[model samples]
Target: MSKRGWIIYNGNLYTKKFAEQIKWLRKTAETFDFEIDVIANNQLLVAMEEGCARILTEKQKPDFVFFWDKDLFLARQLEEQGVRLFNPAKAIEICDDKALTYLQLANHGIRMPKTIIAPKVFVSLEDDSHLGQVIEILSFPMVIKETFGSFGEQVYLIKNEQQLRQKAKELQHKPHLFQEYIASSYGRDVRLNVVGDRVVAAMLRKSDQDFRANVTAGGKMYRYQPTEEEEKLAVRCSQIVGADFAGVDLLFGENDEPILCEINSNAHFKNIYDCTGVDITKDMMAFIKETITE
Candidate 1:
């Protein structure tokens, strides 16, 4: 019998870097007498319309599931059939919805910039009730995001009411947000990979030309120095999302206070490794082994 793991690299092939990583992982598994299988049979839209399993197998009901997408539709399907899924369905939901996660975090005193979730339809814009509340709670230059964003896409820093109105006109058909962008984090934020209640490694992502500091948006990474508090927050985020490990993005404010911006259930690690020389892949594998071995 062969030992095996599944790395769910969902979505269409778009990046050469990811393609290379998949190859590397396949080789690594083969070397260890294990197999790395790419399970594309459980795609979200395909599973919806087809209502069938095309190429999945009972034997391939993975022992270790590396989740790549945040949507739990497919993951929930896997669990009903007894295939263990990482990050669980509920965790996926909480992290997937930016508004709900911050509410929970705020209740726990975890620092976060002001955030708001506006519905797609405004039945009574004249009421000005909820709108007033949002304005009062969050300040200007607030960010509007599409809830599910990755690598810096779908993120908007709304500078003023005119901009917000214009943006709303553009994206009002869909649910969006109004969040306070920490000016201090202007082009700078920390991305920390937390594995199993520990901060494995962190990189400070800086965007000199853009406001979005995510590496995908032209942000460069450097050695990040996080205080114990930030580390604790990272751990807390992991727990909130029910992920034993996650990448926590923390933003610094005018006073240098750490603000929890986003929690990535499946964070990319290449840039961190390239800049900091920290290979979390091996450590993460070790942690997973230890977790199940016990």
Candidate 2:
């Protein structure tokens, strides 16, 4: 019997981008003779009864799940049901929260930009005094990002104290982080797609319109070769995050050294494919097949 799997994406996203990723994953699975089904996260209901977990979907469970959504509960429930998930639940949790990702990587001595976690604030309480310390450490021209965001949508560049305070106040209720901005890496970064222990493809992204080098942010991409150090760092990050595969973004440090930016557990490969002509979906499927067999 051929191995079977399900590729789960966020149905609520309702964007062609998310659908595009699923299309590629399904294509790869077909090539490997693996029966793969594409499903939405919300399509399955997670139920708990008498200390037992069950998925309420009518579809039968597959041998594994290629989870491309950030619904932690659904991911964990699937894991509890003995359905192995690509990148796993814990990996998805850590990577979904920027603060947690940084903390875990820092524990392993990963080199990243200096980051400070924002303190939680209640909606009724208004205060910006605590952020003064952040200003002292990171100064102006810092990067502010929500703990949970993607596609470069909720990131901000604070150029002065006023902007810093305003951004802080706006996000006081949500978890966020502040980091030093690497001038050298402004609007430019490298994205390495790592499958298992190896980087299968890489693309350098440069933005002409904004500080974020994300392709969704109007950045351009080009096929590029990664330095040995860069490759090692990307793979190491994947291991640290407990990810079977990841999209690791590295900022340019002084003298072109690599500094960790962020890791995406369900990174979209369409742009990378267009830029590098390397389809990581195939490597991902192969890795999944080998891992499940092992």
Clashing residue pairs in candidate 1 are: 143-179
Tens-digit lDDT track of model 1 for 1-294? 655677666556537887766665566545555566765434433243366643244554567666656646677776666655556667767777777677667777778877778865654233324555666677677788887667889988877767766676676556667788788889999998988889999989898999999888999889987899889889987886687668899999788778899887767677878988987776666675565556
Best by lDDT: 2
**Number of clashing residue pairs in every model?**
1, 0
Q: What is the C-alpha RMSD of each candidate to the true structure, in Å?
A: 3.3, 1.3
Instruction: State the lDDT at 29 in candidate 2.
Output: 91
> What does the lDDT read for residue 201 in candidate 1?
96
TM-scores for the candidates: 0.86, 0.97
> What do the candidate models score in CA lDDT, each in turn?
0.73, 0.91
Return the clash pairs for model 2, or none: none
Summarize candidate 2's per-residue lDDT along 44-105 as a digit string, tens digits.
88988898878888888899898888899999988888889997999999999999999999
